[model samples]
Target: MSVKEQVCSLSIGIVLFPNVTQLDFTGTYEVFARLPNAQLYLLAQTLEPIRSDGGLTFLPDTTFTQAPALDVLFVPGGPGINGKMEDEKFLEFLKIQGKQARYVTAVCTGSLLLAAAGLLQGYRATTHWLSLDLLEMLGVETVAERVVIDRNRITGSGVTAGIDFGLALAAELFGDAIAQAIQLGIEYNPQPPFNSGSPQTAPAPVLARVTAASQNVQEIRRQIVQRVVTQLQTTNKLNHIYFA
Candidate 1:
């Protein structure tokens, strides 16, 4: 009898909303795609091509309605998330899929969507430094760390932090050696041109610019959370759900 080769495959679903931050998804994808037994899908609301904030366009392999069961679900953040929170269809989809996914991860502002979907209540998470304060509005404990792992939900701080998040995730799923090998393969060394990653370290002038640029997004996020909270209250879902 001939010996048979055993193959293992893990299905991963990445939600690609319009204007999503490219690095948020790409960095994670680069790590996960290299796994020995993994199948990746670029999922979206529609099957049409979606554009990223950085002008990259990608065609989704599956849509919300047609997607298969996913072992891991990834959500990336960008300005487009401002609209998704209030989108009943999208939120409903997230609610359903999130409950079924083995692992749910978000990068950058993507945590905002997860929070909007009622997945982050009572859980600790992190997002872009500029948006960390907003997590509290949703009743989530905000962590100032680069990566936060709360139960099955793993959240990364900002765009570049996704790389670290991915490596951590890989280690969780496989082993430390696997993650180390992948990190080495990708040459994951960092050297920032400017020190503006955090409020504590960034210069006052740089911090001011960051705050100014984030003001519009912050205001929009506030409004969206208010609306979602009202809806949850009306439906009597707030009592059963923990916001923080």
Candidate 2:
């Protein structure tokens, strides 16, 4: 069997948290769900329903403890990532899974969570444009791109880029033909009415308005990243002392 055929039985786990951006997870979910014989898990701390920042609700089907070994470990980002950044249990879970998972992936602010877990420290990653600074503060090499792939780590930038990330990752795992078929099936052609997707392409007033609105949240994220960085540093020191 080819690599594509081998991956047909691959297990994929998507970490879901409260206030997660629905599109960040669902866009990639739609594509991964179409994978032939792939087992996908909506993983969470519990089996409870998770509410998105946009007010949509998703019921997680698997708890972290119940999750099996994953071939792909995916984390999605949203306002919830601030909470996750300092979540020791969640970070430990990622640390354990990430060490063994074949592919460690994230979208939007989710990459920040991966960084907190020490998964992306030396990797070049990207997140929502608004959170790129926070990602960098976590000691990750920040890339301003739609999608960035560094070895086994694949990360995507903000909301809509999840689709692009999904397609690219699918092509990497399966084959170009499979990814093309999936894209066509989803009718993934995008022709936006406005070209204001990026800060560079957006109107000056529009950029100012969004950036202004995001200032407070950005500060909060910065503080969280600081604490996480200190904690990671402390832990590394202790680990080195013990191992030495």
The TM-score leader among the candidates is: 2
Shift of residue 174 alpha carbon in model 1, Å: 0.3
Q: What's the true lDDT of residue 151 in model 2?
A: 91
In the range 55-137, model 1's lDDT, one tens digit per residue, is 99989999999988887888889988988978889888888988998788899999988988888888999998878877777
Worst 10 residues of 2 by lDDT: 1-10
- Worst 10-residue lDDT window for candidate 1 reads 1-10
The lDDT of each candidate is: 0.85, 0.93
| Model 2 steric clash pairs | 77-110
| TM-score for each candidate, following the candidate numbering | 0.91, 0.97
Off by over 4 Å in 1: 1-7, 237-244
Model 2 RMSD to the real structure? 1.2
